[model samples]
Target: MSFDIPDDRQYLESHEWALETDGVVRVGITDFAQDELGDVVFVELPGEGDHLKQEDDLGVIESIKAVSDLYAPVSGEVTAVNEALFDAPELVNEDPFGEGWMLEIDADDTAELEALLTAEAYEDQIA
Candidate 1:
């Protein structure tokens, strides 16, 4: 199967993607991740006030295939979360980059973004 690796976003080897806008960054699993997980049934996200450390567990994603830990790509406070996922976890499968985005972070350090892979590199990594 094919996958989308958006050029505008930074990707983790673990398959999460981060997109920065202004000072805040949006975080979510990549299409490759969701597809591999299959039919996401539930998503447990960090609360708005929670702090996440890079490479630490951020939350859980449950799918028909298996449950997996979602990890943090950067250290930051969760400024907001996607309330929509609570009602429709399948959004992760349907639109992994758009409405399926898990949360927003007020990044403690944007320099960490440079450490993430470019879309091309991620595609090769997945391949």
Candidate 2:
């Protein structure tokens, strides 16, 4: 269950991560999640500009194995969604942290990111 998490990002117990850039936080499912879920078949994403609370169910990702909810890592208003996922959901299983990113939000509070798990902590759980 061990996985490598990028030092530059913060992770959630739900197997999501937040990558902050210029006040906006990019969100995506972890590699472990995609691997467990098998091939991604579809994605249901929140619309741009939609306000969300921390831990809110922002979307659903359908995979060959099962459907999993995608939550907001922190409270914010969604600024963008990866529209490409609509046409090519497999990218989630192929390159989860790269082209598989789900959405970006203008973060409401930077401190919210602190509540997430560190890479070591995340690995411990899945291990």
Candidate lDDT values, in order:
0.94, 0.91
lDDT of 2 at 22: 86
Candidate 2's residue-wise lDDT over 44-99, tens digit each? 99999999999999999998889999889989999999999999999988888899
Q: Which one is best on lDDT?
A: 1
Which residue pairs collide in model 1, if any?
none
lDDT tens string, model 1, 7-112?
9999999899999998698999999999999999999999999999888899999999999999888899999999999999999999999999999999999899
TM-score of each: 0.98, 0.96
TM-score of 2: 0.96
